[model samples]
Target: MAEEKPLTVVTCTAPVNIAVIKYWGKRDEELILPINSSLSVTLHQDQLKTTTTAAISRDFKEDRLWLNGEEADVGHPRLQSCLREMRRLARKRRGGSAGAAAPLSLAYKVHVASVNNFPTAAGLASSAAGYACLVHTLARLYGVEGELSEVARQGSGSACRSMLGGFVQWLMGERPDGKDSIAQQVAPETHWPELRVLILVVSAEKKPVGSTAGMQTSVDTSLLLKHRAEAVVPERMAQMIQFIQQRDFEGFGQLTMKDSNQFHATCLDTFPPIFYLNDVSRRIIALAHRFNAHHGKTKVAYTFDAGPNAVVFTLADTVEEFVEVVKCSFPPESNGDQFLKGLPARPASLSKELLSAVVLEPVPGAIRYILLTKPGPGPQPLDDPNLHLLGADGLPCPRA
Candidate 1:
């Protein structure tokens, strides 16, 4: 038998980003261009992230994808868009060089395997992390470099923001071609060391209305969405940037909550109306407001995406107390140790005055679990061969 062809493989991980200034609608569906500029904080990858591996070989039959161990369609329009763009860019780069030998042949078919550490949907910015990891891994496999936010955006609009670390903003470019509509880093991950994030997973199930579908409906029907995109977001983006730059938690937290509320309100304004927030979600919002009121300041702020899950932002000093308050409000079914995951938070006791001030009936099992994390860097490549998600034969390795 002929010698087996050599395979080139690369593995990388990308972090999820929670939008402070939300991107609710798109101006172009095909290009995944956002209607309004949005800002987001990239969550620490150690707690929440997507890990992806890409391999290319001449023996492979076709371009294929495996997500979370199961095979996924490679022909998905958005997936196809990302694949086509990366290959086109690689081909363009190869053609520009005179006599230099290319590292990998562009003719080889690719197999990609990706898995998210956290829930896939359930409004966790899973698509952003998944697509960012996909593009980042593929870029390494093909030796393509430079700005890749545009390519990632085609897979998922919020994904562009995942291309950078810490605070990021996606500029809703006026260009019809969308070349200028790319994500830019407002600050590095180290910019706000005291900032903390708590993800309260209300439900891990897939959302009833997908973000893409929901956005389209909102764009088609909601007048509020149009006004928010054109009028509100422009000013909010500027103010948000200043707050982050100055390390102003109160301004940042308040703006984050308002933006999230407005986004959901726009959803409600949709023709038939869409409801992503359930009873549990509403309770969490009330708890957050009451807790902040008891502290006589914005001690904690909450933001929800397209699903019922809540992302709470606060400073490092407030994490323990806020986490304690969350537990008291929504008692977890699991043990206290099991209830909290990721970065550790010391146990805190609520005073009688504070407890009475923020009085609310405890809702058992309302929150599935709490993941504690902070701002972290963007997509990172894995250096170890053992970490590759795919085996030597271009198939996914069995989970350990």
Candidate 2:
């Protein structure tokens, strides 16, 4: 092999995905294998994505990480696991484990920089995008030779989907060790080009319940979770894939709404229960139903993860219609309604009894704002060397 390169720099970005068939309860928390199969569409890069640069150098002594220009510890187990896995893959790719050619030390210092265009940990699965970008960039730096999904899965189970663009499925592999539970592409962005998604940034605050902890709680306490995982999702998975393949928006819309409701319902059933959706979220769902019913067709659909925000999906032609509905439903602020004008607004349907129970608290800020998005692609290594995080001496650039 050629002499060890003094510096290696890689830049990559990962797209977020919204599970059409949700990955709710997990059988193996560490392995991240869900009890059931799930499907999602990778979101547009400009709207919601994590851009990352990873590099290695001989001058650096410690492996360090920075997110959005701020120093971040690499000790977190999830982050550590991901970095460890990347290192393992990099060593294997560099040379055989027991090679004789110079026996070059397979170790090199690493530096990472990452930033997210949208909210992080706000039930947007930013980790999926973040880890995916890290894996992709690290793989480039180390010349790791393997399928992108294989590398992505080791970072985070859902992250595997971030390796591929367009519609994807994160199969909850039947294996005990989770080797088979990798993400696969169902369709490319061009496959169904007419799809449009609007991401409402309700309360930019990070989600109180992360997927790992929330899913574990549901698995341990929610009786309905198991049944839904085992019985409900299998059929929904097939139907959803079919809907996407056939471009059946109406059928697809219905399934998206049903699966989202069921996922939240399971959360509500957990011991002591988890309520990610508030009155505002519930109102959005109702408004979606009202709009579709009033139109006599399923022109729009809504889905929510473990947050108060709503991810609204509709055909490109109907996005204006949905936008109009959003503007009419939600209240305007002194800033003169930051939400789009075409979007309609309607009052949230908080039951009188429910509101009375907690009426003292003001509703000064229900949602920070809304984000409009659409289906997008997966991780890619940028060509510009200026995007690199490390310099020729294998030292992290000052900016990094």
Candidate 3:
């Protein structure tokens, strides 16, 4: 029967993840359990990420959320799932019934503000970073600790992988309640210093078919997706992990390319067919193969998520040389100087031999820009209270 503290606030950020083995289907929709195990590389939040802040106050009347400076429905099921699970863990950690029945608003409403530094819903794993940051910041505010990837999973299946840094894998567990479906880090961020990543931002426009809706359709109708989940991903997951541990670029690049093609194949096999890639994407795929063929070994790899943008992987030794090839094939029409961001990529000479060896229809202005990044750490809390997204009134600040 004592007074309870309120106006609690916390802010955090999580990086995006690009699935290499690819997660194409879901077994349990409510639990957000993937139909197959998948692996990914968590990108540095410096290049692409989502920042979120969670706040709770005794005077707040109901839960509210804002995404990308716009008000969103708080009644969303997946969002509710994340919030409920975090609150449940907090109550359980605080001695269950006693904390639930206290005078404090354990039932207190909250205000959530989330925004992405990268384009939202562009298949750049915005949902993954968004949910992971949300769960982590909420845990900080509610004092809930231990495994939180599972909590993020309830928000979005791939979000679980964003909980860890570097190479991560989401193991599709057999539990009906999905307690075992969790993310495990394959290696730390500094595992491979030579590794490099280039994100070709093809378009910032919203994708026609979203990953959630596209995945559901594949699960319901695509036989190829079923075969992939049962017969393909298991072996590929093991091989991908082995290649990463051994630093075998040739092996890793091959699997990455094949898995991306097959994931798109499953999308095509869906009854209505979902198309995430465009002419720009197809050209990039061919360019990658031709570039590798010219090198007589696998020196570069390209993978597309649920969008037209391509995620290219290579080593630092040859990254500059390869990026020069990209510039020649797809030159920017205007404002070309801002074409590349993140790590500073120095210019490398592109000879006619390299250019003529790769046959690609030059498309000016196809890509918006490029993000140069590599693997980085998991979600991190901000030390500055001024960075909080919520105002004193438990609402999103002006900029949100």
Candidate 4:
């Protein structure tokens, strides 16, 4: 009998990306191509990320998947698209070499397990990180290299952005094949060291309307979406890039807020209407504007995706004060120490005059918690055997 080959396992993690210039509608659904180009900041993996482990073995009967400690359908179209494309690439590379035998691992079945440290499908771009990690881990396992953003894009439109570090832009190429529609890095994570991100988790519940379904509805009904895609976004994309390159906080903050507002406006303009922001979301928006006005400048900017949660962008110097202001407006029900997660934030005092300028009735427990993070690198491979989500038997390991 032939000696059984050792099981090959790979583990990796990818960071969540929150779009400043959002990708709303899709031009090509099958290819997951966007109607307009969008840019996003990749959040630090230490706070928000998806860890995936994949293993291939000839002994396995079939491909399988486990997500968040539960068995998931491996036949999901998007999941299949990613798996199929990865295997196709591996096969192509093997065939390109003359007199080279394809590795037996190519024919072996794969078992994958993925888990996210943060909330999933809450408009927090969980799918982006999830799919990006899947594609990246598969690449390492197959020993395939070169650009894989296009393949990741097929899994989730914004997943392509998560394939790279720092600020990334997904170009909406004018092509039928979507060959040019891939993500490119605008700047490295080190370019803007002082910039920070605060994710205010109002609710961790899954969104009522998923992004995919919502986008299709908007494309079919909202004329405002058409105008924004054709006119507004093109200009905003150019200006946003310039602001980031120059490190102009005022320009960046203003444009970020305006783009977010316009994106939500298009949602409202959709026939029958779709509401992603709740009372708490609106209140947070008002707080941000009022806080900036009190300083007579843009100190902080708020953006919302397809859920009620708010993502606030500010500089390092402003984070502490703004966080204090947030606590004042939305008091925590739990211990103050547990209210903040991720990066450590020093306590700050608010001046009486400043507090008076931005007054609002305090609402206790409105926000669940705040996740403080900053620009960080993209997908990374893990070398530690203990970090693997799957066991030696090619199955999800039981949680401790």
Worst 10 residues of 1 by lDDT: 1-10
Q: Which digits, one per residue and each the tens of the lDDT, describe model 1 over residues 1-400?
A: 1114488889999999999999998889999888899999999999999999999998898999999999999999999899989999888887887775565777789999999988898899999999999999989887788999999999999999999999999999989989999999999999999999999989999999999999999999999999999999999999999999999989999999999999999999998899999999999899889988888899898999999999999999999988888888888877867899999989999898888778579989988899999999999999999999999999999971
Lowest lDDT sum, 10 consecutive residues, model 3, at 96-105
Task: Work out the TM-score per prediction.
Answer: 0.98, 0.88, 0.96, 0.98
C-alpha displacement of 379 in model 4, angstroms? 0.2
lDDT of 2 by residue, 1-400 (tens): 4337565567887889888888877676665677888899998887677888876666679888887767789887777777777777666655674553432234666778888877788788888898898888877666675676755665666888888899999888888977788888999988888888887666778877777788889999988998898788999999999999999999999999999999999999998789899888877777777777767889989999888889989987877646645654564464545654223443345445433332333344454566676788888778888866556654446765
lDDT of 3 by residue, 269-319 (tens): 998999999989999999999999998999999999999999999999988
Cand. 3 Cα-lDDT: 0.89
The per-prediction tally of clashing pairs is: 0, 19, 0, 0
Worst 10 residues of 2 by lDDT: 354-363
- The residue pairs found clashing in candidate 3 are none
RMSD score of candidate 1 (Å)? 1.9
**Cα-based lDDT for every prediction:** 0.92, 0.77, 0.89, 0.93
TM-score of 3: 0.96
Which residues of candidate 3, in runs, are more than 4 Å off? 1-6, 96-104
RMSD (Cα, Å) of model 4: 1.7
**lDDT of candidate 1 at residue 261, scale 0 to 100:** 96
